[model samples]
Structure formats: structure tokens, C-alpha cells
Target: MTEVRSTPTQRVAPEEPPPSDPVAAAWTDYLAAARQLDGVRRGAATAAGEQARSVQAAREELTVVRARLAAQQSRLRERGVPAMALVPSPPEVTVAARSMAAGPAAVLTALRTARECADAADGVLDARGWVAVVGVWRASRPEGWPDRLRNLLVYGPLAVLGPVLQVVLVLTGSGARIALAVLLGLVLPAVAFAVGWVGVGRFFRPGPDGRLDRTPRFGVLVCGVPAALCTAGILVAVLTG
Candidate 1:
């Protein structure tokens, strides 16, 4: 007993508690599954929304492309192109189908490309139309007619109309009618000037560059001068005769 050594006391780590009740464990599993299902639903909804937007955009693009193509086809037909020549070839149809095979996004891209091509074609056609119109204008007018002279051709007629009517009234009618003609002389020239300004901008304004047809000063003079002269001449004739 005296030779026996004292042994040191060893500490034991405590064991973890046993698994929770089966019902509680099952409830926890159910909650995890429900959360995962909810997440999946949200993801699917997001994808669907994106798909719907893409589809709508593609449909709009298709409509625009179809309208442009139809217009171009009509224009080609008007320009003496055979209907058969305007139809897409089998290879072209196949190529177009292949381009849109990737899905709605691809279809949208193809439609946008087609729209740009249609716009370029429109520009070329418009340029050609302008050239034809300019050629006709040159042929109709005297060569070397300045912008002012060309514009005057349009403005001059409108300007003279009021004065001519006033002169006619003066020659045919007396006192009250003459007074009416005189009053109209003041009003009509301003009206004529406004009409000519609009007409010049609408019909005769040059090209895609958007230059003004002629100076407003020139138009004002062309429109106003005739009326003023006719009014003066009418007064002189009335006083003398």
C-alpha cells in the first residue's frame, strides 16, 4: 500500500444530446423543401418574364420588317420590276430561316438587320427620286435659273392672283366694291406671302440636305410688290377716270 502511487484524475468530455424528435426533424425538412420550391418558382417566373418581353419585342420588329418589305416590293413593282424578280429565292428563304433558328432573340436580331437594310434601300430610292425630280425641274426651267428666279416662278403666280382680282374689281364695280378691293389689297398680299413661304418650304426646298428654297426677303418682295403696285395703279386710275 505504501509503494502504490496516486493516479491523476482524468476529465471526460460530455456527450452531445440525442437527435431531436422525429416530428420536429420532419418539420424542419419540410420547411427547407418549401423554401427550395419557392426559390425555384421565383427563378422560373423571372425566366418566363424575360422570355415574354423578348417575344413581344420580336413580334414588333417582325411587323416593322414586314411593312418595310411590302413597301419596297410595291416600289419595285412600280419601277417596272417583274413580280417574280421581287420574290425571295429558295436559297434566300433558307438563309433567312437559318438566321432565325437560334430563337426569338435571333429572330429579333435578324429583323433589326433587315430593317437597317430596308432603310438604306429607302435612302437610295429617295435619292434617285430626287435626282429625277431635279432633272425634270432643270428641263422645265430656263438653264442657269438661280434659286431666287426658280422660287419666284412659284411665288409670283400666287402674289399676282390677289392683285389681278383687285384690278378686276376696280374695273367692274363702284365705290363700296372699290373700297373692299382696297381693303383686300392690304390683307391679301400678307396672305399670299404666308402661302408662298409654306409652299416653297414644302415643295421646292432642296434635297436631303435641307437647304431653304430661297431667301424670305426675296419671297416677301415677290409677294408684296405686285399688290402694292396694283393698288397704286388702281387709285390713280380711279382718281383720273
Candidate 2:
């Protein structure tokens, strides 16, 4: 029996059959993966662009911020604000401390109360074009000859006197005429600036609430122009002499 028996055959399980549309299935999977990868790539690129734009805008804004700060610093320097003025203090400020508390306190308290009352009363100023207080308070009246003469008497001499004093000071202190002339040169421009600052503030301002007839006048004509003209004449005389 052993001689006649055949070797035992090995048994193998059948493999799973491939899908009928195997190529289509593989192509579908490949396309889905490609779409997912494309979505991720687009999102990353968009985020990078948005970040770059934000950074660029911030840089541009920084330049404007720096310029404004520099201008403010320059103004403060020109005004010569004291270091002590920058020291932090309580919100309450007392103009006079004499006797530690009395009439001055009462006056200041009254003034503050009055200001608050005025502001509250005139809260509609912008809405009413500044007529909400005291029956339409107005600008400084255009002055006639007498008033003009009075102002001129007060302000005109300042233009001439300031430059004269500066020139005299230079003449007395300096040995060389050239140095004196240079100082005069510097002083005239300074006088022009001073005259313009004061004159424009006091005389050339537009009327209250920017009225129709409130166009600014040439305040410089009263002070700056005269000073400049006189300085020019003096310059010519001194240089020629």
C-alpha cells in the first residue's frame, strides 16, 4: 500500500479576485489624493500672501507714526518743557497754595464749576454753530482807525524796538562790524517770525465759528511786514556804510 500511495497534494486557498474596474478605482484614488494635496498647497500660499501684505502695510504705517512722533518732539523741544513738568502728579492742580486752602481754592473751585457748567450749557455749540451760548457770541470786531491806532501804538513799537534792541546788543558786544551785521541778519529773521506768530494769533484769526465774513486778514502787515521792511533798509545802510 505504501508503494502504491501518491504523495499528498498541498491545499491552497484562492486569492481574492481583483475589482472588475481596478484601473478606474486606482485613477479615482489618485485624483482624490491630488485634490487634497492641491487644497493644502493653495491654503498655504494664500496664508503666506496675506501675511506678507500685512507686514508691508505695517511697515508703511510705521513711517508715518515715526514722522508724527518726531514732529511732536520738535514742538516740545521748541516749547522747552521742563523735566519737572513731566513728573507725574495728582490730577488735581492748585494754582495758589497760600494758606493751604481758602479764597484761592474757592475761586478755583468756582472757576472749574463755571467751566463745567459752560461746557454743559454749550454742548450744542457744534450743532448750533456756536450760537448755543450767550445769544451768539461773536468774533472780534473789525477795528476802525482809533482802535487800529491803539493796537498799532501797542504792537508797532514791538517790531521796531525788538530788532533795535537786538542790533544794539550786537553792536555793543561785538568788536567787528561784520559780526554785528551778521547778528543783525540773524535777528531780523527772528523778529519776522516773532511778529508773524503774535500777529496771526491776535489779529489774523478767522472769526468765531468760521463765519462767512471771517476770512483771515493779513496780520503780518501790522507787524511782520513793517519789521522786515525796516530791517531790510537797515541792512542796506549798514552793509553799504
Candidate 3:
């Protein structure tokens, strides 16, 4: 038997690869994509972590400042001084600083000049002037956020109805349309007043200073007045038509 096998020893060739190892290719491709996705996820996570840390730091700093302010306020109260009276007004720097001989007379003169300047500044910052300043401040502030989202909840169906009313009035034939138009015409200003008052609170919310500063009333005037005028124009058009 050993001799017969030794006479002819033919080696079998290795098997060829499959036509297309699609499953293998797919697995390799999936692994490559997974690697890329993991890299992206890691990068995003790092960025989000950095932003979170920054926000936390700012919040901590604000808390410290608030605590300090509260302590100062308590101290002021303990001294029996009215808190409003003790709150320091902004510093007044004079244009002219004359070198005076160190004396009581010089001190008195300096005090009088400073007081006069303060009075003038105060006169400039009355209600109307302050309203103008608030307008300018509000103008510079960013917008385009959803306003009084809670109001949307409270007004619910009415909010839906308000738009629907307009749509219905628009669709109806002339006479009924005119009636609906007139109703909306009267309702709009009161709606505006309510909305504006609610909106003002968002603008006047506690800023850096804990005091309540008036929000820009200008937004109301800017948006509401024009809307009212447009409604009136529509009414006029309807009447004329």
C-alpha cells in the first residue's frame, strides 16, 4: 500500500475566492463608517462639554455677585438707612478740575458745582426721556424669540380663533365680512394692549441690576400702531368698495 501511494502523489490546488465577497465588503464598509461616526460623536461631545462648563462657571459667578449684593443690602438695613436713599447714583466727573488751595471754601464750591451738574442730569432723565432711552436700549437688544409662550397656553382657543376670525372674515361675502372686520377692528387694540403689557414684562425682566427697568414701549408703538392703521385702512377699503 505504501509503495502504490509513493508512485503517484498529486497535490490538490487551493480553492479560489468567491465571485464577490459582498458580505465581507459590507462588513468592512460598516466598520469604516462606524469609525467615522464615532469620531464625529466624540468631537460633538467635547464641544458640548466645553459649552456646559462655560455656562456653569457664569452661573456660579452670578450667584456669588447676588450673594454679595444681598449681604450689602442687609448691612444697609441694619444701619437704619432707607435702602433707596443709600443707593449711590452714578459718578459725576467734571470737565474742569481746577487746582484749589486746600480749604473749606474750595470744598463747598466743588460740592455746589457737582450738585448742579447732577440736577441737570436728573432733569434730562425724566419719564419721557427714560422711555426714549429704554427704546434705544431695546432696539439694540436681540429679538425673534417666541413671546409669552404661557400666554399662548392661557389664550389657547382665542389665539387660534383670532387668526381664524380673520380668515373667516376674509372668506365671507361683503356685508358679513364688514361686520366681522369691524368687530376685529375694535378687538385688536385691546388685544394689543394685553399682549404689549405681557410682552413688556419679558423685556423688563431682572437684568444685571435687580431693579425693574421698563422695557422698550417702542415695540408696542412700532408693531401695534401700524397693525391698527392697517386694520383701519382695510375697514376704509371695505366701506369704499
Candidate 4:
């Protein structure tokens, strides 16, 4: 009978970790710090979702590979091969095993990773949902009474003033009525146009893309509609009288 003695094991070089993306790491760290400080999230929904999916996919893949490794080990043992030689397991498998053992007992070897994946998904989903809900609520909220009143002060009186003054002057039956009408017709429109130009421009201050919005919405709301209504009212009063 020949006795075989175990030889001293050769030191295997450690597996180097996968190279990391520096800019991505920096941004991720920054985002984590921001989140810890309760700051607003950037790229909330889409980015978080992708991260969760990546983790889940990794966990699933690892689970499948580890299961295959176990079956392969069993097959080697049944075939009278030296199964115990490679029994120590790979570094990735070791780390995963430690985490799994340290955690609650589970049927699957990748349960620890799966739980981590679930947690990551939950946190991101909650944050994204909360941000969306707040955004929608803010959008749907009506303008405050104070702002509306302030705007009315700026626009309402201007609309009524011209019509009232013209009506009063026309009712006086003075020979100057014709000249007054001509002056009002030209001057009032010019005033409305000037007011519209200034109001609309100012309303667009610090506008998007550093470009001023010259849209007629504000101008029409503040000046055009009022001027039209007042002019119509004045015309009606003059003709009826």
C-alpha cells in the first residue's frame, strides 16, 4: 500500500475586483449624500429603476450559477473524481455564502442578495412615487386668492376705466365728443399695446432658455381682452345715446 501525503498548497492570487466607473461612482456617492440630507433627488424614477433591475438580474444570475456549481460538484464526486480539491469555492461564492449565512436562513442560496435587491427597489419606488405625487398635487393646486386679487387690481380697473370715462363724456352732449372719441380710439389702443408689451415682457422675466416669451396669452389676458370689452361697451353707449 502506498501512502500519499498532502503537499503544501500554492498561494493563489486574489481575484481583482471589476474596474469601477469613476464619474458614475462620484455621482452615485453624491446622490447618496444628497438623499441622506433629505435633498431633492435628481433623475429619480428612471435611474433608480435601472439600478434595481441590475441588482435583481445579478442576484438571479448568481443564484443559477451557484446551483449549477453544486450539481457539478455532486457529479464529480459520483464519477470518482477529486471533488474535495476544488471544494473551497470561488471568491464570489465565498462572499455570497458569508452574507447568506449571516442572514436569515432561506431555501435559495441567493436569498440575501434577493432581499437586498428587494430593499433597493422598495426605497427607490417609494421615493419616485412620492416625488410624482407631490408634483401632481402642486400642479393641480389653484392659484392663491392674494395673487388673483393683485392681478385683478392691475388689470380690472384698466378695463373698466376707459369705458366709463368715454360713456360719461359722450353723455354730456358736448360738441367736443367727436374729437374725444377719435383721441380715445387712438390713444387707448396705444396704451393697451404699451401695457401689454411691458406686462408680457416682465411676466417672462428669467424665462426658459434665457429667451423672453413674447406669447400673447398674458398680453391678451391683461390688455387685449379688457381693451376690446371696454371699447365695445363705449361704442354701445355712444350709439344708444
Best by lDDT: 1
Off-target runs (Cα >4 Å) in candidate 2 are: 1-18, 82-241
For each candidate, give its TM-score against the true structure.
0.53, 0.30, 0.28, 0.29
Please list the Cα RMSD from the true structure of every candidate, rounded to 1 decimal place. Answer: 12.1, 24.4, 32.2, 29.8
Task: Identify the superior model by TM-score, candidate 2 or candidate 3.
Answer: 2
Better of 1 and 4 by TM-score: 1
The residue-by-residue lDDT of candidate 1 on 156-235, one tens digit each, is: 99999999899878877789889878888898888998998887777664644656656688888888898988888878
**Each prediction's whole-model lDDT (CA):** 0.86, 0.53, 0.56, 0.59
Candidate 3's TM-score reads 0.28
Q: Which run of 10 residues does model 3 get worst, by summed lDDT?
A: 92-101
Q: Top TM-score: which candidate number?
A: 1
Best-to-worst TM-score order: 1, 2, 4, 3
How well is each residue in 1-241 modelled by candidate 4, as lDDT tens digits?
9999999999999999999999999999998988876643456665677666756766676676567556555755664769557466698677766766633233243654555665565576568669988988855543222334434444555555655666667677774884485457546755764664565445434333565444444444655564556556666765786
- By lDDT rank, best first, the candidates go 1, 4, 3, 2
**Model 3, runs deviating above 4 Å:** 1-168, 200-204, 214-216
Stretches > 4 Å off in candidate 4: 1-157, 217-241
lDDT of 2 by residue, 1-241 (tens): 3567689999999999865898888999999999999999999999788666655654555455456545544544555867555333544444333332544334444444544544453454344544544243332333322344434543566556656654665456454754554556556655654664555346643434662221123233554565566556666756777
